[model samples]
Target: MPEGQVITVTGPRPVSALGVVDAHDHLLIDSPGMPGQGFADVALSTVEARDGVASGITTLVEMTPIGLGRNPAGLRAISKHSGLAIIAASGFHRDAHYPAGSWVYDAPVELLRDRIVTDLTRGMHPADWHDPSLPLDEARAGAIKGGASYHHISHAERRRLEAIGAASAATGAAVLVHTEIGTAAHEIVDLLEAAGATTDRIALAHLDRNPDWELHAEVAARGVTLEYDTIGRTKYHPDSVVLDLIERVAAAGHLDRIVLGLDLGARSYLRAYDGGPGMRYLMTAFVPRLRRRLGDDAVARILIANPARLYAMPVAGGAASPG
Candidate 1:
C-alpha cells in the first residue's frame, strides 16, 4: 500500500512545528447506516471535507466510520486534498444511536475486540468494503470509539462498555467514549478502569453536559482527559455552563487533562445558539479569551499540549502556528 505524505501530526508539517490538533471532531460522520451521499452536509457542500482546516483547525480525528458511512478512498482523497492530518476511527457508536445489534453492542465482546484490533492494526471498511489486497493495520485509522446514549442509559449499554474495555486492553489504541446524559459519567470511568484499561489513554467525551465538578476532578486526577465537546453553545447546554466547567477544571489544577472539540456532525444543523459560522467559540472566542484570561502557557496546555499528549501523538517539534 502507498502511504500519503507524512505531514507533522499536530498541524501541517513544517521543518520545526507542532501542529494544532483537534482531539476530537466529526469531519465526515453523519447518521448511522447511511451512505456518504445521503448525508446532508456531504450532499450539500464540498466544504464538509475541508471545514476543519478552513476553520483554523489543522488536524482532525473523524469520530466513526459507521456513523459517517465513510469510504477509505474518499477519506484519503479528502486528507490529501485538504492537507490536514486526518486521523480516522473504527468501532460503533452507542447501540441505540445506530442499529441496536451492530458491531459495538450485539457481537460477542471478544469478536468486537478482535475487529477493533484488526481495524487499528489494519483499517476499517464500510458495508461494501471487501478488498483482500489491502493491509488492515496500516489503514491509517487512529482510535476506537463507543458511546452511551443521549437521554438514558439502555440495558445493553454495559455490553458496549465491556467491549470497549476489552478492545482497549487487547490493543493500546485510545478509547473515545460518549457518556449518557447527566448521571452516567463516573460509572463509565469506573467501568473502564475496572476493566484494566489505563486512565492515560482514555478520554471521556461530553463532560460539560453533566457538569459534575467532582466527577471531572476525579477523572482528571486519575490522568484521564475529559472532552468538553459542546463548543457551540447551541442545542444542548448553555455557554456559561460550558465555561463554568472549564473554569472548574482549571481551578482544580487539572488543566492538562482537558481536550477541546466541537462535536459537530455533517447531518446536524447548527443550532441557533451555536456561535455560528467558523465555530466562533473555539477559534474566535474561546482560544483568544482563554489565552487572555489563563495566559498563553495555560491556554497551550489546555488546547494544544493536553490534546497531543492525550492522543499520544508525536510532539517533539516546535510550537504550533495558528491555523
Candidate 2:
C-alpha cells in the first residue's frame, strides 16, 4: 500500500481499512499569528500521520478547525495528503478562540445555532486559521463538535453549549463536549436532553478526568457513550488515575459503555514538554498494557467494538460476536 493513500474498506464485512478510528485528534490546531500547524506539512509531516494510519488508525476525526481558528483549505489539503478518511468538525470553542470582541462571542444563540446547523448540513472548508475563500458544504464535515477546553464559566461558554444543543437537535449530528471543570459532562447531558437531543447522539468526552465511577455509570445509563479517552495518560494526569478509572469502569460490568482515544493535538509538545505523552502512546503503551491486563477480547471490545458503536461506524468489519 502506498503511503498517505486511502484504501477502500473492502473486507468481507461492511467495513474496511484497519480496525481503529481515532475519535479525537487535532491534526491542525493553533492560535492566531502562529501560522497554524496543519498546513505546515513539514511541521508534523503527513508522512508521520500516514505512519500512524499504517499502525491501525483507519480513520481520524480532526476537531480543531472551526472554533480554534482552523482553516478549511488546510484541512482539505491535509485530508487529501493523508489519504485517510479524515472526518472534520464544525463548531465553536471557548472564549480564547472567540476572544472578547470577536463576532462569535456576541452572536445570538440562534445565529450560532444556524452556523453549526449549516455546517453540519453543508460542509466546511478547513484550510488554515484565517484562510479566505473556503467552501461550506456537506462533503467536508461528517459531524459537528461543540465544546472546547474546560476553562472559564462565562455566558459565552454557556451560549456555545446551547448552540451545540440546538445544532444537535436540528441536524442529528453527533456532539463531542470538552467537559468544563466537573460540571460540563453532566450539565451538557441535561441541556441536550432538555433540548431533546438523544443520548446516543452525544458523547461525554474526558469522563476520566472527574474519576467518579458512579457518575460515569450514570452517564452511560443515559445511552450516551462515555469516551474513556485518557490514552495519553502521562499528560495532564497520572497514570494511576487512568488505570484506576479503566479498572473501575470495567469492574462495574460496564466495559461495553466506553470508547477509547488518545486526545492528541498538533500543538501538544510531548517530546519538548515533560507533562504529556505523545500521540503514539495509545497504539504503543496503552494497547499492549490493556491486552496484558484484560485479555485480547476485552481489549478488542474497548478499542474496536465500542468505538464503532459509539461513532455509528459499521460494526460488521471483521466479526459480529457481541462483546
Candidate 3:
C-alpha cells in the first residue's frame, strides 16, 4: 500500500527490500491424507531456512492455506531464523483436502470471508483450527490462497473461491489460485474476477505443469500473474521445458505477468528430509541455468520484480479497479 510495500512475515516492508522471492512455496506445512505426499521440512526449521537462504530466495511464500496445517507462528520463526522474508497464505486449498463434515460443508460464504479476513488482518488461529479453545498466533497472513478443481471448479470449491474473492477485495491481499496441473485456469480467473477480485492482483499457480504457452499468454493478457512453479521436479518434466515455456510467454510480452516459485510441499522434495532438491534449488540450480539460457533480465523478472508486484497489496482507500 505504501510506496513499493509488500507484506512479509516480519510485517510490511518495501518491495525493494524483498529480493529474489520464491513466489510460491511452503514452510511449516504438515498436511495429512496424502500418504504419498509428505515432506522433510514440515516444521520449516532453521536448517531448512539456512540452505534455502544460501540457495537464493529472500522471500518464500508459504502456501499451505488455512485449516490445513497453515502454521503462521512457524512461518514467522522461519523468516526470523533464516533471515528470509516469508509471506503466509490465508483462504482454502483443494476440496479433497477437507473432510466431508468439515466447515466447508455448512459454513456460509460470508462466514468464510470473515474468517479469512480475520486471519489476514488480525492474526492466524492455530493450525489445529477445529478446536475453538486454541489461541491465535500473532503472525498474520499476507496472501489469500484459493484452489480450483482439476478441469472444472466444483460447487464446494466455488464457495471457497467466492470467499477468497470477497476477502481479497476487502483486505487488498493477493489472491493466489492453485490451478490443478494448470487445468481450468481461464475459468478460475473469470470466476474470481466476477466475484470482485481484481485481475491485476490475482495469480495462477502451477501453470508450467500444463505447458500451454498459448494459454499462459491468454491468461496473462487478461492481467493476472502466471506462477510457473515445479522448477526442479524432474518427474513433471525437464527444467528446459519450464525455461522454454517462460521464454515463449516472455516473447509474447507477458513477462511482467510471469512469476516463479518451487511448490515443494512433499517430503521427497526437501533435502532436509533426505529429499533430492531442497527449497533453494531455484537460486542454486535453476537460476544458473536460466541465466545461461534466458539471461539476467529473465532471471530478475521471474525471481524478484514480478514477485514483488504480484504480492504487493493495494493502498487502502485506493481500491484496485476491476478489469
lDDT of each residue in 1-323, candidate 2, tens digit only: 11121112111212233367677766656644234432333335355456556556766666664656555555555556766566667676656555456677777888777666655444454442134355553243445566645644467777877887777666555677767543567677787677657787788777777778988887887787777676665545775677678778888877887777666654443332232455556677677777777788887777766655555422222122211
TM-score of each: 0.79, 0.79, 0.93
User: Candidate 1 or 3, higher TM-score?
Assistant: 3
What TM-score number comes out for model 1? Answer: 0.79
lDDT of 1 by residue, 1-323 (tens): 11112222222233213356666666454565444423433322235535556656666666754444655555565667766666677665666556654444455766555665555544555431234355443244556676777655565666666766776665555678877663566677677777666787688887777888778998889878888877665668656677777778889988888888776654443322222433334766567756666787877676666666555422222112211
Which sequence of candidate numbers ranks them by lDDT, best first?
3, 2, 1
Whole-model Cα lDDT of every candidate shown, in order: 0.60, 0.60, 0.80
Write one digit per residue (lDDT tens) for candidate 3, span 39-149: 434344567777888877778888888767776766777777778888888889878777778886578998788778877776777764676567877777788899987
Model 1: lDDT equals 0.60
Q: What lDDT does candidate 2 reach at residue 289?
A: 71
Off by over 4 Å in 3: 39-44, 316-323
